[model samples]
Target: MKIPIQLNQENLQEVGSRMPIPDYNREADNTGIVHIGVGGFHRAHQAYYLHQLRQLGEALDWGICGIGLREADAKLQDIFNKQDHLYTLMVKHSDGKIEPEVIGSIVDFKMGTKDPEPVIAQMAHANTRMVSLTITEGGYNFNPTTGEFNFDNPDIQHELKHPQDPKTVYGFLTAALKRRREAGLPAFTILVCDNIEHNGDMMRKMLGTFAEAQDPDLAKWIAQEVSFPNSMVDRITPVTTQTDIETLAQKYGVKDSWPVTCEPFIQWVIEDKFSNGRPDFEKVGVQFVPDVGPYEKMKLRLLNAGHSVLGLLGALHGHPTINACIEDEVFKNYLRAFLDKEATPILGNIEGIDLTDYKDSLLERFANPNIKDSVSRICAESSAKLPKFLIATIHENLAIGGSIKFATLVIAAWCYYSDKEADQNGQAVEIIDAMSTDLHQAAEQTKTDPLAFIRQESIFGNLIRNERFTKLYSEVVHKMYKDPNIKKYMRDMISIE
Candidate 1:
């Protein structure tokens, strides 16, 4: 099929597609939100919602100005620049239906490598009342053990010393807020859209730690002025591929260089706290609440943690994508047992949320054949992800004397996957973690002594000292190693009959 028109601000009125395009005036829209980490999730979710409001003529000022920090971001900067900051979002439903929309919320963007000065200037600009972030779970740079900002990190140390010539995000935020202070400008509300549990509070601590290292006075000013509202954002956006772009052009009649494909479902639950007033996101189905704690915990324990379980086990079983994992009975049954027997016991109640229904919804989402969500993507950054997603459930289960059968399996499955060059079906399993070198080395050491992996003090932190956990983990790892094939062993171990 021939492409109808190139997706751009100039071609929206002329483009023919099954879905909608922004009819709002782009030139008249002013930038109100400077989003750090312009990636797939931010574009598909928050940016999509903002575009909704923009189309309604309600959010003319909340147009997004995206900022890309890393060197690789230059690719995206060029992609957006060529398209006039308009990209297509193709929503894939579970039933195999596709809905494509052209989003025009991102009015401007700055590449940090090209000119860091403009990013700071726009961030400090009076129109920029809020700074939102989707920089992934690990980008916050907190010490895993200490639960504080890792000021001792070499990059952070450099930023602390030279605040003006900043590199780390903390430094940029610190410098921008300082400028706001001197100029008597009201500090922007810091909205954290990451997956960290108690995200707002954790962000406050991290940013506050950065500020304190710079100047005690500035630290105090930030603590008093800025509002870091905790938020729960849920969407399964797979990494974009060139194939996705080609398919969009072929099937949807739109030619997009870099388009984001996401599931039809999307949800954002935010705490009602903003230093500077926020946009009318509630109009677009954003849940504004008095407290985001319950919602945060629910999503973390069930969705994020559940993803980790499926991710590690799926990889070990030689499944490539999440839907592939869902297709297997052994994995799906084990996941349900983990949720019902282990995770749900420790979970506290969230107001108006039906836990059972939520769990069912997760199963449906995970089983969505259209999403094409990769197990490898979910398995990436295991060092950061496992601690956030799985460790909490382990600690809680162990403390309460709940059966850790599933937690043990979760860790054991990861160990089993890491200890091999390829998964059970001879599919290559890449260990992708920032700490992969050290973690893989430790995993290799565990071949001799099962305790080597758990002995990483920064990650385990005295958890190995627990007699029950240690015994169970050792037994699980030893059993996993003794078995010649992982699939047969997992069948018996998880009781997958």
Candidate 2:
């Protein structure tokens, strides 16, 4: 039996030449980016870009200092502490090839759950030019439908009452920015790396709202001095399983306690705006655009919406993973039709992108067998996802007289999935959402009141008011409840105008 070498700074040479480790020195004093919510996606996407840049012997000072706000992040902090913040990124290609590389961009990690002081201090540091976030869709503490910041959030309320000891992301940010301003240092640019439309703008609004409540002067300073650049980030990073960890140790002879596995394809498009200096990411294939609106819209509508369509429908049909759903001819065809007929038409001319090619590529990416992207993972946060991904498309199409038949069916499927909480095969389908209880209750009322699910005004938001949409949604819900032939329904809906 081959002894697995522990992944750390000291054992870098012992890991052998097969896996690529950081060639350049990772110095703590050179940390320029303080990123919050250091989860799988951020590591695989943003940090990977920096790793590539560092490999070219550029942006050596741009090392990332990852922050974990929740108590659950203690595990990550422990792993990073042991490995010297080094972790493996196993890239799984569609054809069953796996490339393992140790990424050294994250030089340090701070746990804010126990004490927010160090995290706050790191962000306030003059060397820290930017603070990026991948806190997921629901992390921003905002109403998805209304586009309003949720001040009623307990964390936000606590932070407002006691700003000295921070709780939420906004609290940490406000505290850091306040410290920076008080010390006569420039504010760090807030770069949002989440999968929301106009993420940067949204961050600015939420932070500004929080800051304004804390102190009007600080709010004005943040508004004038800080820069929030909107960005569109894409990469299919599935949750790492134990099998992945064991494979790394057994095959590559490297034991990574918490490694990130993702698909080969990755893309980052950002608006070229920053309060402070930034790394030369343009050289690393990061698209620096004048406006990320078109790109963001295209991605949110197609790639993300497509994922939701497959996820909700796939869950209903008892498909375990994304690739499994794609393997089904009906599911594949349904996704294609939705993209080509519904999602694509509503997306106006996206500069330098062929919609046809992009849509085709999405199917190929989704069908990657090695990734094993779970239906449950994709379905985890439907309440947050559907509003931005699918419903937004439906809203736009409704205004423009475009076909929403495909998108409507996905929502209807979601209602079914939520209500049944069991797949067609009688397997208990886990309904994981912030509003799961509410969703289940609303969906259960579909028997007597077909419009109950859509009537969640906070989520559906006047979606129930649209007579055409309600009619379509009601008919689909009733049909689904009667006969849960998901694929058959998909086939019938594919040809609908």
Candidate 3:
């Protein structure tokens, strides 16, 4: 089957057999939201949801104008621009079923590499009522353990120097909000859709700090007027590959320049607080509540924490994708035992969710064959991820006097995997981290001294002081060096429960 033409709005109607398209009356809709980090997850999740709203003739004005701040984003910006800010979202089912749709929630895109002025201008527009972000875990510019904005980062330093022609999101946002304050316009609802715990509050803190450094008056006004609502979001969207683009054209008969692939599951739970009005997201499957704290903790423990357990071990074992790790009985059992014994006892309850059911569903999603979620993807930014996803959980378990076997094992795996001197199957280990050079140097020292890695008080805090965690973590790392048969070692460990 051949697509009649390329996947632009003009040709959306030609691909009806594949699935529906946003062929709605979208010409009059204004851009009410400017989303930063318009990557695969954004396209597969939030943008997809907004596209659904447009399909139902609701909240048409809440369209997204995508913004990309990094040099890497320029290529994506070009692809999105060529496709008229439209792309195909292919839902990959484990049972070998594919559901495809041409999503059109994004009406425009701006790359900060070209010029930050236009992107800031879009945010300053009165019609833009909100600015949503999916800037990943590290983009927040904060030290995970200290929970302080890393103002010393080179990017932040540059942003501080040139506030007007800002390059970082913090710089652009400060400039935009400053304009709004001067013009006597109401501040936009700062909706942060990232995965970190208390993401909205984190954004408000970091962004506000940036503003305060620039203008104290603007910071005060923002603190008084702006609303930052915490939210919980879940989706298994993977990085787009060339195969995804080809598959869409060959199998689905739609030529999408950049297509997102993911499992057919998504969720968004938001706190019910927004200044200057907001959309009724509850009208379309969103959960609006007075508080999203309990819900956030539930996701952080089960989903995010579970990913850390799977990711480090899988990458160290040289499993290319997460599904391969899940296929191993030992790996699957490890996930189940860790969640059931180590994670769940402390997770407690969310009002509407069944804890057992949610855990089972999460394991199933991890094993979803269609996702092809790479362990490296999760393993990236370990310098930042471990503190939030694993260390905090470890500390929580420690404080509550709960079991930490699996959590300790996760730490051991990270310590071993992060080593610059180690190799996975004769191939040099690839360490992707914000502090890669520094982390690798420190990790290299641990190749001989197991406790050397965690001694970085900034990363592990005083967990090194705890005799219990130290003895277990050291023993595991030592065994990793002594035993060459990793497979049997994993089996024996996971057999504990």
Candidate 4:
């Protein structure tokens, strides 16, 4: 057995010649970007891009200082402290190739679970020119139905009352911006890297509204001075399991407390707008476009929505991973039908993007055998995901008199998945959603009231009132109840479409 090399700055030389290690002087680099919600996707995507830039011996000033906002982030803080803020990124190719590299872009980390003062100070620091976030779809703290910031949230209220002891993302951001303005420094660009539609616009509106409530002058200044650039980020980074850690140690002989694993595919499209000067990300395959709307819409509707299409239905069919689901012909065909028939027609015309080739590439990415992206991971936040991914597609299709059959089936599958909380094989499937209780209750009501699931105004929202949608939805739900052969149903639906 090869001896394991503990990953840290002092042991960089020991890990040499096995996988590529950072050759740059990490200590000399400045933290030009401060990223919140330093999760797997963030590490695998943005941080990896910066690492690639640094590997080319450029963008040394654009090092990252990562901050974790929740109590769970303390685990990351511990790992980063032990590893000297260094970790391995093991990229798994479709053909069973594993390429590992030590990424040194995340030079420092701060945990803001207990006290927000240090995080705020770091963001307010003069060297920090950009504040990026991957706080997930729900972290924006907006009402899904109204599309407005939720000021009544306890954390938001606390931040409003006690700005000095802020906790939420908005709280820390607002405090840091206030400090920067008072110090006569320019505002940093707010780059939101979440999967939301028009992410930059959403961030500006939410933050500006919050700032306005606190101090109107500060809100006005933020609107005038700060630049919120919309971006579309894509990469399939699965949750790192214990087996992944063991594989890294046993196969690669590198002992890392926490390392990220992902597919070789990655893409980021950002609007060419920044308040302070930005990094030359364009040098490293990052697309800086004028309007990210077309790209953003295409992704949200097809790639993201396609995930939900497979996730909800796949889970019910007893599939464990995304690749497993996509490998099955029925599931794959269903996804293709949803993309080609339902999603593509509404996308209008996206310049520089072939919808056919893009959809085909999505299938190839999902079928990557080495990436064990769990169905549970994809189905975790249905309440937050459906609105942007699948539900919006259904809404638009209804408006344009297009097909909602595929999307309607997915909703029916979600209801069954939520109600039974078990697969067709009688194995218990975990339900993870903020609206789990309500979802389960509403789903359970489908036994008597077939319309109960769609009646949730916050989620389905008037879709139940549409005659065509309600009729289609009711038929699908009843069919699921009477016969739970999801694969057969999917095949039949494909034939119908």
Candidate 5:
């Protein structure tokens, strides 16, 4: 079985359709599992898992139908049509090995807003047993500080008015659940696969808030019937570039028009509660836990927290790649100290987890040179990320009177990164966020009041009101602001010698 040299649509299908010697599609019967925000991560992780289950005969009756929220429909529509809803997944490793796999989890695609009538009606179908989402942390439109629904968002307002014609993810879920309640249908599980602390609980809160706002009857129905399952999903699927396309065609010898590349390592920890039913994912590599809290917290506090700390710091210091950042003596040492000295104390001991081994493997993953993932790319939406990565750890650490000095360094790095005018070589860097302008404005006010700069009610919520964090953060900010060379300051502060 020789591999192809170019992976375009035609060559990919010709090869993909024949590989693994199994036809999972034949066993599938469109058991309704609507997936929202079908981006690269979903395609790489969750969809890949389901495709494997179908191949193993457990998910034979469960096929995925992808729905695009907001303006995501056009781009995904083009990709689905180009490749017949079949795409190539290249699993790349630090060892310079590449495994090209054909993923067949998605059978149909619809831009719900483009054709809202049929898509909304489809949710009412009896076979539709679940609704899974990877709408990102920001897509939920929940305030990061308070972790409550942001009803003030205009899009949310639109959805509230026309619940059936949902303009937001919460609106869609709430409206669909209402339909199920009216029909006396069992509520399907609402699975949230994002990098948030207690993803299930957070999602449930948003849905609960939305439901409460809509009507009391609908709210009570959702509370009793629906189960929001928490999950920990991990994979590094960088945004695809044209260079990736060229490499896929030249290196893999298959023509995959929209191929998704990711690291070989993947993890998914899920709660085993399903309202209607779920595939037996145990045969694959998924961990079914009694409570997903500990696992979720560990990932969020360590890997996710580490990513933001090094990511923004790396960006601020002009390191382009995450590997390069980890390789830098200053940044790498800062990260090692932060994770071990700061985060470990707060994370404490979780069952089956060794903090030292976890940090070692995480560092290795971050140092994979072949994975040219940029800090800027991963550092997008810091407003949503900080709560999960930094603030949550800060909260726990504060409870025990543990020092948040390292956490303060990470926060300072974020403020500086947001204020930088150019990249390492002085190339202009684009700040990507709805909150960027506001962050910039806040950064400008730092000279007058360091505490004011740190007090983004949107990012930290009222967590800054804590006298301890405010006191500690004020010290870090004043020092970083005065020194004007934070990289050197970090190097000196974490000096081993």
Candidate 6:
């Protein structure tokens, strides 16, 4: 059956307020903040916040122009077309409660491959104040091993060779800024919403690297004029399913075909810097921090790392979803012990939030039954996520002689999980990380020398050289593989006793 084009809003069964689209009568001119990669996370998190601001009668000029780089996401395109650029945001809560919000932050959408002209025009528009990016970590064409711009990438090479019709996200951003500079438009803020450490600094570095490789003067200008505000954004939005669409229609009476589903928790912390103009995003729950470092570390290390640890391990242990993983007695204990003993002590000062309470809340959020977030999804870019989430935490713990065993267990779990040929149910598991080949090789070598097996630079990075962590992790992995009663081993490893 063809899904209805509109949500039957009257028949909605959820408990959240239907925010009447507020009077955005203050018709401000089209000032561009070209957002690259309008994915599920953007719709659920950043766009939802913008929708809130719009609802409260602010940020009239804070309009977003979305650009999709690849053409494979025809489903998203079709849904937008059917709804006239509208969709539903179904927020899943831990308490079996649901909040359905209508998000309207995205005003325009353009395909980079097909409709390059409009996308480029919007990017170069005189009033374009910022270029916000939600492109995945790999989207920047950064080297998987070094975390630097992958200059040799064919798309990047094409972009550098043809600046007028740039293809890559970094290229498109720089080319647009170059055009603005020629038009005497002041440089715009480059807001980065990726999970990289010092994301703003990374953006500037990547742009600088891209431009310097192309033109020295353009690189110099970007270094001086661009504002790359470090930010931390968090929300657990799963890939939307057909069930989501049916729920929207049957429960809420809304007819959105491409409704987004997400966990209730959301956070955005921005460094207070804007060149041309910026939305009063602060007015809509976005914390304006003087230094976002502490919070960034907290979120990446605690929340994100927590997700990574559970995700791969969950998949390997026969749990289908994150909710199911946490329900398992062993994983639950592992997570609780991890947050309390291994993860929390390494955390330094973060302004306004209590560590204990924060961690407690995070566990509750993880245990949210309504949100069927899968372990495989969070494990998508474990290669990239591990550095930002796990490795740094390990470093901090090792430096202080703090307990890192539970954290090590998480890493060990990932190693075992990654090595597995089939999923828990005997289905073929897709290993998506760049280090998959090396990891598989190492996993096979584990029978001979577990420590030596993990020394692969492709996955473990330099941390494998640290004899102490390597030994501990190897011992844990050995125990896990050797144990006859795997559930007992998991429980014993996680137990404080």
Ranking by lDDT: 2, 4, 1, 3, 5, 6
Between candidates 3 and 6, which one is better according to TM-score? 3
Cα lDDT, all candidates = 0.85, 0.92, 0.82, 0.92, 0.78, 0.76
Which scores better on TM-score, 3 or 4?
4
User: What tens digits encode model 5's per-residue C-alpha lDDT throughout 1-497?
Assistant: 33543322345445755443226653235656888888889999999998888887677767888888767567877878776677777777888877777787787777777657555655666878988998888787777766667889987788777776677777777777777788988988889998887888888888888888877789988888888889999888877767767676676555666778788879999998788888788788999998988888888888888888887777777788788998888888888888887788876678888889989998988888767787888788887788778887887778888767777877876776666545434566778876898888887777787877668887876766899888777777778766656687687668743
Expressed as tens digits, the lDDT of each residue in 43-154 for candidate 2 is: 9999999999999999978899999999999999899999999999999999999999999999999999888899999999999999999998988899988999898888
Q: Provide the TM-score for each candidate, comma-separated.
A: 0.97, 0.99, 0.96, 0.98, 0.93, 0.91
C-alpha RMSD between model 1 and the true structure: 1.6
- Compared with the true structure, the alpha-carbon lDDT of candidate 5 equals 0.78
lDDT-wise, the better of 4 and 6 is 4
Mark the 10 consecutive residues where model 1 has the least summed lDDT.
484-493
Q: What's the distance in Å from true for residue 169, model 3?
A: 1.4
Q: Candidate 3 on 1-497: residue-level lDDT in tens?
A: 77435877666677665677886655524789999999888888888888887788888688889998888988887887687887888999999798888888889888877678888889999988999999888788887767888778787788777888787788888899899888888899989988788899998899889888877888899899999999999899888888888888887778878888989989999998887777767777888888898888888878888887888878777788888989988888888888888778877767989999998899899999888898888888877777877787788888888888888877777766667334345455667787887776766787677888888877898899988889988888788766534566667777765
Candidate 5 lDDT score at position 366 = 88
**Residue 483 lDDT in model 5?**
60
Off by over 4 Å in 6: 1-31, 143-147, 423-427, 483-486
Model 3: how far is 476 from its true place, Å?
A: 1.1
Task: Supply the TM-score for candidate 5.
Answer: 0.93
